[model samples]
Target: MARMTDPTNALRLFQHAFECGQIPVERGRIDPTLMFACDEPKGRTRFNYMRAEGRTLSALVMFVHSDMIEGHPCFNIGYAVAETFRGKGLAKSTLVAGLNEFTNGLNGACIPVIHIEAVIAPENFVSQQVATVIFDSTPVTITDRESGLPALHYMRRINLPMRRL
Candidate 1:
């Protein structure tokens, strides 16, 4: 089941990013189904995914929070694909799909529009390119809250309140 297996991938991502926290392996597992809910029951929820074809690749997920950045919504994306999946347009397509879903470009009952604001680490060039080209985002220097480190903040605005059809 997703509950039993997702943590393995989550742990891989968490450890690989060096996010500076000790992953508690003994802790109760989180249910992956909760991610697709219309709304999160708790704060800081993110949608997670793996490629449908036997999941040889994982889609690093992005989350948009209603509460952030001076009381307005903002997106903080963090994702990683297996090394083998890199340079194959996977990340670009993933980002495009995500942006379209959030920006009323896709059909749905209610599309919640939230601007994506990615903070790329200084050395992460590929992601920077994705932000710049796909989202047409421009970056500015800022300090990352997680590590108090210098980073690039890429912002792409979107329609607000989403569109209800």
Candidate 2:
């Protein structure tokens, strides 16, 4: 698992996906190098390999590149699942794992992440559909005045430090 974080490994997988046209890199998006360069001080970036049946289904990234919101950091969940594994619930479930880590202590108490975001393009219907199920509320369209991008913004929040009656 530790080796997956290696820059070379990430580059290999990223290159494969890029060559297959599964991701948009030339359109000013992501570069494989970014996966290795996610460091501290400003924000955090992490790229995890999604494995199924001991085989890699996707390379998912959950990055807290932005500062915290209401004391909770906002990390964006981005993934590039292999084309062959598309239409299956792998991506949807992968998203659930991220949301769960924030809500529940699925990843343990040390990393009590609570808020996450997923910004999707208007035309990406597959992701739009997944976002609908992942978030409790409907996806919000960010207008030019409201935000920088015109993508659909989806967020999940869980108030931590629960009280007992």
Candidate 3:
């Protein structure tokens, strides 16, 4: 349940994941300069799930604010699981946890009508399935934002459950 505020740490995790075969090379390396672009006051947040020893990264989830969805305030979601932890459903669960944290942080103060968006490579069927299960939305074909490749987009509205005050 560690939050990664430093771009370097997050990039390290990403590189590790890539080296361990979690991320395919075709996705291309993330530009160092852009890593902190979303680290603004109200732009992006990253969640890191580590193994029990707290040394190995099990999964990573990030939500970045985006205006690509038209009318709906959206946070584009991205995530990855370590190779050793893959196929165990770690990615989906971690993403759920990340979303809960993000929504809860709103604190009902100015609850914006927002939605979560997952842009996945069309060839990566596994992630597409995960996003469908979590978001319950049919994916629409679109060009990948970063790669300029074909992608599938999944989205669903999010709300902060009212607390019993």
Candidate 4:
């Protein structure tokens, strides 16, 4: 379960998942965007990890740096688990693992506080439920980000003590 930063490994992992048809097409289509996003010259970082067993990728999670509410440092997590591994909570496990790695790796260098935020479409009840379970009573809100449509914002503090780098 190593977090992959090498472009080659990332691309290979993505291609394998796509070829298997185990990933939702809509979400899997972001592979190209992720490639571009991670290659940007800016300081923003995108961390990706693959769950593997004997050289085969079973699942992956991508954490992209983003602002939660203009001033808050947060990570937007996107994940996909292989069809053969969906119901066993791999998504949740991967998420937690990514969070821990991100917090430890970036806590002192990035913003002073670490928060995880998920912006889910209002009608995506399953995503909302997942966030609720992961965040455990953290504040949730509905926001309209100039799209004229409401979206759900779920937030959780990572409890990392942060200091300016």
Counting clashing residue pairs in each candidate, in order, gives 1, 0, 0, 0
Please estimate how well model 4 matches the true structure, expressed as its whole-model Cα lDDT: 0.57
- lDDT of every predicted structure (CA atoms): 0.51, 0.52, 0.59, 0.57
The TM-score leader among the candidates is: 3
Compose the digit string of candidate 3's lDDT tens values, residues 1-165.
322222235546565655575643221122211111124335345333222113355666667777645565677777776667789887777666656655655556565567788777766777777686678767898876566677788878865565555
- Candidate 4, clashing residue pairs? none
Residue-level lDDT of model 2, residues 43-157, one tens digit each, is 3555343333322334343444444887766666565455666677766765555444434432444444567677776777887787776677777887423244467778877
Q: Report residue 20 deviation for candidate 4 (angstroms).
A: 14
Which stretches in model 2 have alpha-carbon errors above 4 Å?
1-43, 47-49, 59-65, 101-113, 143-149, 161-165
Model 1 shows how many backbone clashes?
1
For candidate 3, the 10 contiguous residues with the lowest summed lDDT are 27-36
Q: Which digits, one per residue and each the tens of the lDDT, describe model 1 over residues 1-165?
A: 111112236526544433342322121123221112122325666544333223233444455463455444666655555566678876666565555443432234353445567777778787677666555646789887666777887776565564455
Q: Write the per-residue lDDT of candidate 4 for residues 99-135, one digit (tens) a residue.
A: 5555665657746666676666667665556566567
The prediction achieving the highest lDDT against the true structure is: 3
CA lDDT for candidate 2: 0.52
Location of the lowest summed lDDT over 10 successive residues in candidate 1: 27-36
Q: Candidate 1: TM-score? A: 0.62
Better of 1 and 2 by TM-score: 1
